[model samples]
Target chain A: MHPPRDGRGPADPPAERRVGLILFWLYVLLYGGFMALVLVRPDLLSVRPFGGVNLAIAYGMGLIASAFLLAVVYMVLRSGR
Target chain B: MLHETSATAVAIFAAFVLGVLWLSFFLGRKGQSASGYYAAHGQIHWFVNGIAFAGDYLSAASFLGICGMIAFTGYDGFLYSIGFLAGWIVALFVIAEPIKALGKFTFADALDARFQSRGIKLAVAISTLVVSIFYLIPQMVGAGSLIKPLLGLPHEVGVILVGVTVTLIVVTAGMVSTTWVQFIKGSLLVFFCGVLTILILGRGLAENTGSLAPQTLTVRPDGTRLVDGKPQERGHDLRPVGTIRALPERYGSRRETGALGPLAYLATLEDSRIVTWAAKKRVDAEGTHTVFTPTERSGADLLKPGGSFKGLTTGNLADRLDFASLMLALFCGTASLPHILIRYYTVKDGEAARRSTVVGIAAIGMFYVLTLYLGLGAMTSGALDPTDTNMAAPLLAKTFSNTLFAIISAIAFTTVLGTVSGLIMAGSGAVAHDLVENVLGIPMTDHEKVRCGKIAAVALGIVAMALGILFRNFNVSFLVGWAFNIAASANLPALVMLLFWPRTTKQGIIAAVTVGMVASLAWILLSADTFEKVYGLSREASVVPFSQPGLVTIPLGFFVLMVVSLLTARPAEHRA
Candidate 1:
């Protein structure tokens, strides 16, 4: 059973805490990269990178895919025994 | 635009609204205690809570607003989709577990848990109320706009109807009924949108080679409308526009490509030519003269980032900064929102909170992916109403069948209900739990607390209705942008520093919340967009360098918190 509720907030286990921060910064970098690309080299987004789809579509879809995958990974790593 | 009210639409809409009200009454007996009224006794199942997350997050702005933007502006709308989904990463990896462990009812509960200070409680509670009201305006305004076409009612009636119904939902059962309504709404939205995407893929794209003459609509001072040099009788008098002009040579003289895969659909569109429209308005002795001019462009350019976001490819510095600031706000806003924060208390434990967020991300991400196909399909459906872009998704369904259109419109209406109920629940909790009981130090029993919460819900509902009517003409999506920026600026820095920095003083948090809220609000009111749209003055007279304040104000929040903490910090031995 969980402990009684109180004013001071409870802390997560150390291993879980470390793992969460690592994954959190990893995603920050990925999203930051997308923004940087848009701001610095807006013209390059027009290039057809793959499957006759431009880099803009490919990159935008890739960011969405990455978010889901990273979330599933976090859940798997942090699941209870 | 004239929308002929269909009897079938009114029937389906009435059935949906009645069904939701019945569910609230059925659950009324379950919420008699403070915990039950606030967080459903923290006994809600993880899966239900997860989809309820989608229901709360995917507002009318996400469905009708994003789809319409994409249908009209191409890739710029999808940019919003990407930025929105990315914020869930911060929620899952950082906020989900800690917030679940911290709060009881309101977001203020979490922030004040460690401090137990009245100032902290007061500032956070006010921020919660302000953010909730700003967010509520867009949802209420969207409800008003949608009812005009679906029920043939005036905009004010729709706003009042939604306000009354949502208040009843909260006053009766609180979070129990709100969560269930969201679960039902979320399920139907994803399922129906999937069906629509499959239908779109099956039909594919076709070229229309008819005359490309544009139409002109002039509104006289006395409220008469003239279309194409003749008095407008019905909406159909102005013919539907938007079509593919030419296909790639790979099809070898074939005009339509029947039944396409998702990637193939995008690739095929990239190689074709599409017809897009541009609108111009002029005023003279008659009235306002509006013309929709059609122009053909290579699909390659249309699939990029410059259709609605001008100066993106042209290397204009001011426009790029505005785009970047908006994206930054969206990235950080999801975890900071008061309604989203309060949802953590509905589940049992930290583990449940984390798991439910994953489920939310999955459902929400899938819906966003399907939005691309739905918007692109609407772009080439040749049935767009050029005047009102918010009607794009429903009108696309109309091209298929009237029954489908009716069902989709009803689902969109429920979308408004679910989101507004969540916002009102957040606002009422802040008033009764945070302000009255905590800040003012008023003693109350469990029964008294529940009654106080119910009364607050009614007051907020009335306020929302009044603001919705007053701001009916303002763009719904533009107002939503203000909510996200303020939420991120005011709430995020305080929450992050409190969890991470042990030396954080109570004074620092109070400063951070106050500075972030005031600075962002001040910047928005002084922005160029506000100068032209709200103040009716020239854009050049504005003082702010850019419109979005996140790239500047969010960091300012962190800086203020750090400086205040250092100035007021205790010695190392005196800490804790």
Candidate 2:
């Protein structure tokens, strides 16, 4: 990850930065939750969440869809600011 | 096993290639200056570059390799897709804007902007070449794999064909042509894959044709095939095999699920019984013959994680660590890739870079979701060539129709060309821009600089072709893991420390990059996978304890940087 050495871009309020960081970590956690399931209990992933879809497949698809969702949200937040 | 060469597939492949080359030549005139050659004059719109980002990032590994892995193994392949897309989060949050703001032409420019040190330039340039070359290997290999069935040529010829073609593309226009090529190919790949997934959902899953007979393939001492213990004549290929033996039995007459929705498809397959291929090679005094045996399995078991990576199951400590190490590398590697990072420089500003990244994540994420269907469709398609899992997707396309197969293969080929061009661009920039201009203190005009970059591109293409031919047997995704590991190990620590740590010195960045690159490279060269697969040696003789080194080398890079920086930091009173 490229670390910004000094701020040279659009400045954001402290509150916005805090919210962005929180949301970023929350997304990471959402991903981490699936991975943790894979590590600790992958069998749980095979368990069906609904009629035909299992937990692993559902959560995996969710993780993919949510990446797009979160990216749109982040962009919206940035532009809104 | 698919040896039939369709005339239509060849015609389509040629036309698509000629069209791409024509476009490259047309755009090549625009980027004559140094900035234009290197960064597309920073004139690319965020949307176009964003889609190009998808094109550049979605190499053969993502499209062909991941699909093949899922087609053969199952959910394990999707793990690579997830890890890859997730890396953009780090890119979006940490790297995107700064990369655009700090750098002029190449990845080295951004890293060396804050430090005018020649040491940093030399270190970063070498690391960029290493990462780019590593990434190029799998793309070239994927190219070779596609050519075998579509063009009916040897794998080496396919490598040479693509190497020459991409070098021509890069020599013509540099980044401008590369960007447009990527933009076009990226759009086509996603669009066609969406079409193919729809076709799969429409066709639905079905039972294997007629009887569930297990086909046995035996090679005689003379290399002739024996099917079911009968010696068949040479040049006759075996039939494609893989099928669903027993269905859910709820259907009236025909024992197949007619049409399945995306979700229902997986569920129905999980509840049914399927026959998958398993091969065992036996050695005699004359030669070695592989027997393609069928193993009856429940679809539920096949849909789980243990098929490809034994780590998720069987409870082996080393395997588990290997899996985790690979996932970590993928997560961290995306932002660190030199080619991926340089795309940000093609945009106008920091905010454009950020916007482009979000667009990329959307495009990439959507395509990855489609991969699940594509791969699963290929899995039960009964068109699988049991010998080469890499051929799964294209072969699945052929099962539908020859015309679709040709189109998909052509798009897959373009995928390789686009990715390889980006890699060559990054490598050439490292050599010409950073290594020569900055590190060696060479003086040259903008025109001469572009010339130097073009020459470097040719040399890098030659190297890629050779490596591609050497690593033909390995899957593209597995080869990509090595690239990701090296990138994450070498670049991530230094980039992160330079931004966050006030005590970080030029010596520290140089040290971290060198140590990380060498350590990871050494680990890979000595690892069991390399010993067994690359070197044709016994795994017991391998030096490294595990195959993956990210779990060790990534943190090791940080530790080395910290220690070296502390030792070399200038006195506070003397600091700027």
lDDT string, candidate 1, B104-180, tens digits: 89898887777788999899999999989989998888888788888889889989999999999999999999999
What fraction of the native interface does candidate 2 get right in terms of contacts? 0.43
Segments of candidate 1 deviating more than 4 angstroms: A1-7, B235-237, B283-285, B573-576
**Residue B87 of candidate 2: its Cα lDDT?**
87
Give me the overall lDDT of model 1: 0.87
Tens-digit lDDT track for model 2 on B343-396?
Answer: 998989877887898889988998999888888888888888877777888888
- Candidate 2 chain B minimal-lDDT segment of 10 residues: B230-239
What are the candidates' individual DockQ scores? 0.51, 0.46
Score candidate 2 by DockQ: 0.46
Q: Docking quality tier of candidate 1?
A: medium
Q: Put down candidate 1 lDDT per residue, A1-81, tens digits, no spaces.
A: 122235346457656677878888998998888788778877788898788788988898888888889888888988743
Candidate 2 vs. true structure, TM-score: 0.95
